[model samples]
Target: MYSTSTQKREWTYTPEKLAAVRLETNIKFREKYESVITPEELELFVTPEEELRMQRSIEDAALKFADKFRPHIWPSVKWTALAFFKRAFLVWMVMMGCFYLAMKIDEFYITIDDFVKNMNVGDPRQNAERILKLEPELMKVLNYNLTVHCPYRPFEGHLMDMKTRMLLLNFDLESIRRDSMRFFQNALQTDVLLVYPPSQIALAAINFGCMLKSDEILREFLRKMIGIEEDSWSARDVRPEDLEKLEKTVTRVNHIMREVEKQFVAVTEQERENHKSRLSQIQNLLPILNERRKEAWRAGGCIGQEPGLVTEAPVDSDDE
Candidate 1:
């Protein structure tokens, strides 16, 4: 029984806390009223006849309420609208996705052409045919089905601007573009995009792709971009230490994408399905793992078997 003041103020209570409070309040009520109220007297007061009367009254009241709603029932229009909207939204997503793909494909191939010229390939004709033949296998590795979802859509403008900015800094823009595009292609096929934000993923892709560059200006740009996005901090506000830390994060993201791409290339579709199933099972156990930790904390036990120590961790759920 919370105090009346709790109603006036904004009070938040967890289920366990609320239940404990309620039980304690009832115990105090019983202790105070023990002189006039006894358990035997309370039991006799709620006799069988009284219980039946309460049940009958409840049922009658419920029927009366139901009768009021009978005239208002208009054939459940909300569910029908909901179903239509679901289908319509799915269609819209598909259309927009197709548009994005077309634009990106044109851009990608244009850059690829320039990249090819820069490399001065020994046999451009053979290379073109080989790339065309590999298209189906590449799509298979991407696990692309009916839907084509990508994080790149949001970062598209930022990256284009980044290229312009890098060129002004006198950096090797051509190599950065080629390598970053390759990393982006590999990253699109991996789950890293789901794990990280679009900005971070883009920076990581670029960071890993441009590792051989001597300038290190792109890394500084990325650190500032990420710092500003995450903390609203300007270029001058970002410390060298923070820049170094974020650089490591980008490197890690790139490494993970590379590893995932390797695995995707190595595995067959059947093996991929098996891997997916195992990952699903492990994911299902995550909630139970967190609940176990909570139980240990409540019992004054640490997760690693130490006494009187509790560990609290924020659970990272997969929303995608």
Candidate 2:
């Protein structure tokens, strides 16, 4: 279904495209503010990589919240929620709003008060209000696309295939399933979901799971699934280049997983504190930037209101 989905047509990007898009976005940011802010102020802006790291931290925190959510959130819902976060660089509040939206879209509805309480967001009424106000923006950022296909089902399919078709894999498939599930969980923290097809991700997880089990099992799985022997000159159907490409992709996914894990482990509390400090600088700069934009709009005879300002009203403190 992913082959025929809108996600494949519109959302998917090659590695080069992704890098070019990030470069263009950064260029646009500088172009927008170069005239309004001093060079020193502009120098304070976070680089694209730093911005990505900050977003990843917030995303990991959101994932933890989703894991502990009551009534047990679906894996699909969690993946969809993260997809939204990755698509847009939003603040912590809006990220939660995205999660709430993903839940509703996935038919896992929880009352706003319940969500606030269960998520331990302080001041239920205010938090609910904030989430509601930002819901539309989150939806718009996602382009109202709610359907996200994750690798879990395909992952299970691969396990089932192995159990049914591969007689050589006579050992308990449950162990492989468990290891694959963990690999998939760790993959969620990386860009594999965005960069690779679900089937490929599933295959990579299975491959890693087999590797964790034993080298013999790994060799067998690779032999059956990847047709390792088919690469021989006697093979008539399979192209060597195609097989090479497949192997490269699987290796790349594993490499990405390890690299991202290293990056996550390297992040110290002081590094996070530095990120917050940089955020404060941006926050302080936004009001001036907004005012300048408003002035320019007014000069063009177009009235505009200030954005990103939340007016908190007195509301119920006890949402229980």
Candidate 2 positional error at 260, Å: 5.3
Candidate 1's displacement at residue 28, Å, is 48
Pairs in steric clash, model 1? none
Off by over 4 Å in 1: 1-149, 167-174, 214-217, 223-255, 258-262, 267-320
Per lDDT, the best of the predicted structures is: 2
Q: Please, what is the whole-model Cα lDDT of each candidate in the order they appear?
A: 0.41, 0.70
Locate the minimum summed-lDDT window of 10 residues in model 1.
73-82
RMSD of each: 26.8, 7.2
**74-176 per-residue lDDT for model 1 (tens digits):** 1112111121212222121111122223223334223323323322334755644554554443323222221222334434555676765445555554556
